[model samples]
Every structure is written in C-alpha cells, then in structure tokens.
Target: MKTAKIHLILSCLFIFSILSCNQKKEQKIETTSISQPEMVLDLLDLQANNKLGKDTLVTIVNDPVYHKAKKYKAVSASLLVKTEIELNKIDSKNTKIVFECVDGYKPEMPLELFLNANPFLAFEDVDAPKGSKWEPILKEGNEMNAEPFYIVYPSISEKDSRYKWPYNLVKIYLEPLNKSTLELYPLKNKKLETGYTLFKNQCLTCHSINGIGGTMGPELNYPKSVTEYWKENELVNYIVNPASFRNKVKMPTLGITKQQSQEIVDYLKYMSENKKKI
Candidate 1:
C-alpha cells in the first residue's frame, strides 16, 4: 500500500510542474502581442468600410524630398478633416490639430493652417529609382521607420523657413486651445520683444523652452542650453549661419537681421535666468 501511495504522489508532482510551465508560456505570449501596436492613420471616413485605414489613398505629385520630382501616393489630410467635420458635426471654430509622431514629437497648429498647408499622409513612393542615392533612409540616430505613414507637404520646400515636416507620423489629435501658461508667450521685453516674436515664429515650433513647446528638438533652458556650453559670440554666429559653423546643423537660417539675432540670444538668456533647474 505504501509503494502504491509513493507512485501516486510522484505522478501528481509531475502534472503540477507541467501546468506551471504552460501558464508561464501563455503569459509570455500575451505580453509580446500587446507590446508593439500597429500604427493607423485616421481620416474620420464614416462611409468607408475601413474607417481610417489605408483604403483611402490620394496622390501627391512633385514631392521635393526625393530627387527628380518623385510622385507619392498618399491620403489627403484636408479631405479627411473636412469629411470628419461634416459627418460627425465637429466644431472646428477654435480647433487645433496636433500632429503626433512615433518619436513623441507633437506640433500643434491652427486648423486654418491644417486646411491651407495641404498636408498628406504618404505611404508608397511611386516613380522612385530603386538604386537612387536619395532614398529615404534613417538620417539621425532615429530608428523609427518612415514607412506606412510620412507627413508630406508637396507645395512647401524642405528648405523653407517654416519647414516643420514630421516623418514617422503616427496619429492626429484635434482639440481646442483654452489654456494660458507662463511658457506660452514667455516673459517679453517691452523694447526688445521682437526677438521673442521671431523666436516664436521660427524656433518655438521645433525647440522647447522650459518644457513648453514642441518635442521634436532639444530643450533650451531647463538644465542649461547651448548658451551655457558655447560662448555667447559663437552661439550668435551659429544661429545666424548654422551650416557655416557646423557641417550639417539641422537648424536653417531664417534670414533674421543682426539686431533680431541678438534679440533672440537675449531672449534665450532671459529664459536661462528664469529657468527652473531640472
């Protein structure tokens, strides 16, 4: 009888071990599935069966990013927003469209700009040479793929002063602007405040000051900016002509006057003084 009991006990232990292993395997599979979600481009098409999928495609001609005027097949952002507004009866009076990228770069612009900008969601590149040297590969250390969705404005040049093109484009948020913050307009100097306005028009779209602007570029003031590292004179020169100083500075010259450049520098200094160290 004791020998029989020992055999039964061993069999029970073996079954318990197998059950535990199976549970762990199931849990791992579940976690892996939820980690990387597939990105989707929404256009608010109520009639379309696919809603905001790749079904609704538009054509973009003469794309300047590639050489030789390549053609791109994309989705018209203007059409999507218009349709959504009409279909769902959305109030676009004080609307602000936020373009969100996969790299956490969000730039919110007015709804009028969204309509006038003529932005599109480019997916497949047509008329592109396979062996061409101008293929859209990774530029910086960014690993995010610009495939499936790339925000492109055909009319605007890549070298334009207001060139705020975002690649690896993911989602779009439409909301109303109803809040005022210290960083929104920053502390303005009564006499030299044109620098502040210039900074808002040019730099504020990309670079953030005291955690209150776009997320694509680096933060300027919190922990100490380029001003703290580089000398004042050198920083001024770099701002005026970026490529002359460094081979390929991402920032482009805005053609601001010497007085304006100094104003922007002074504004940076002002932020640094008021910056709360992070």
Candidate 2:
C-alpha cells in the first residue's frame, strides 16, 4: 500500500510539471505576439487651432506602376500640419516635417512642398470600383487595418520620387532642414545632383549624410559610405527589393525606379569619394 501510494503521488507530480511547462510555453508565445506599439496621432493637438478643415472629398492616385487609383473623403495634410504647428508654437520657416510609416518608410517633405503640394490624408474610402485592385492592394499583416492615415499627394506626378504614398503611418516629426549642410554641391554633374535630391527626399529622414540628417539609419558618407561595403549591383537590387536580400530587413521599399536607383548609387559614390563636401 505504501509503495502504491508513493507511485500515485509521483505520477501526479510529473503531470503537474508537464502542465506547468505547457503553461509557460503558452505565456511565452503570448508575450512575443505583442509586435509593435499602436501608432498614435493626437487629433486633439492638431484640432486645437481649428485650421484643419473637415474631411472633404479627395481622390488618392495609386502608383500607376502597381494599381489603379482610389478615391476617399480625406483630411488635408497641409491644414492638419498648419494647425498642429500653430497649436504647438513651432516656426515652420526653419523646421522640416517628417512622416513615418510602420514599415520603416519615413520621408521628410520639404516645408515648401508640405504646404504648397496640397497632400491629403485619406481616412475612409469613397467607394470601391467594382472588381477594382484598390482594396486588394491595402497592406497585409500588421497593417491590415491601417486606417485614418493613408498619405496622398495629388499635386505631384505618380512617378515622382519626391514622396511615396505611405499607409500605416504612425508618427510625424519636425527637424531642421540645415540648408548650410546641404548647400555644398561640389559635383558639377546634374544627374548626380538630381540623385542627391532624390536621396534627400527618400533617404535623408533615416540615413544621415556627412552627419547632418537623421540617425535612424546608418551614416551614408562619413569615414565610409555604403559604397565601400555594399557592392553596386547588390546595392541596386537591395534598394529595389530589400526582402530579396534579407527576409527580415527593417527598411521598406521606397518605390524608386531602376534608373533612379542607379543615379542614387552614383550619387552615394560621389559622396563617398568627396566626404568633405557633404
């Protein structure tokens, strides 16, 4: 009887240990599933100045290379920023505004373009065209329900690299343009100069040049630029499709063309060769 009793107690203890392990495993999965933080754009702060108009009927033109266009009743990005700036007591003369998406796509729109370009932020679709590709192209995964923040630049060409239409946007920040840092353009090549502009539009928000831009990304040209490390062809492929090289890369595709990628790469090479100019 004593032996039987001891065996029964041991079996119960073993079962308990197994259950405890399973429970811990479940908790571990749950903890890892949190993903990223919910992006918050304080509408209250933006509305304080009352410059942001109501949601007006606006159309969002999808990049023609990918999908057809979609329309939405959206808010004015310009007015929203105008109001926000006024409420926050910020001077727009010297500060640059940045829009950041969840997928590491951040673009710093020139204040002139931010005001004059007349971009809109579409929160809701107007009406889907029957059998259209609009809704089908909305981002998948964590951005599945990204609403109230689809960027639209109606004034610019669809092919323009000045800015990209980014959804799942999370934050907007202000930084100094630092024209003095960017004014030094020693290279006489017009193509590389245009490429530099493209880099400023698409990359300056994350990657710093000569230690003048943002720090979210690596320094493009200081002691050593990307040209020294990443091969030219590989760099081109990486820019066009980052996921092809690394499955878990944080950098999102900025929608640059093949030619544009080449130009940007050449510009980076120039910067690498002439680091003092930057």
Q: What is the lDDT of residue 68 in candidate 2?
A: 61
Model 1 alpha-carbon drift over 4 Å, by segment = 1-50, 53-57, 82-91, 102-108, 116-118, 129-146, 153-165, 175-182, 276-278
Which candidate comes out best when scored by TM-score?
1
Q: Which candidate is the best by lDDT?
A: 2
Instruction: Please estimate how well model 2 matches the true structure, expressed as its whole-model Cα lDDT.
Output: 0.66
List the candidate 2 regions with Cα displacement exceeding 4 Å.
Answer: 1-53, 61-66, 87-94, 128-134, 138-148, 154-156, 179-198, 205-278
> TM-score of model 2 relative to the true fold?
0.51
lDDT of 2 by residue, 20-138 (tens): 99999998765543322211245434445553478787755664422566677678887776654542434456666667766555666566666778888766566645653234344
lDDT by residue for model 1 (69-125), tens: 555667676776665444133345565666677655666666676678777766656
Tell me the deviation in Å of residue 115 in model 2: 1.7
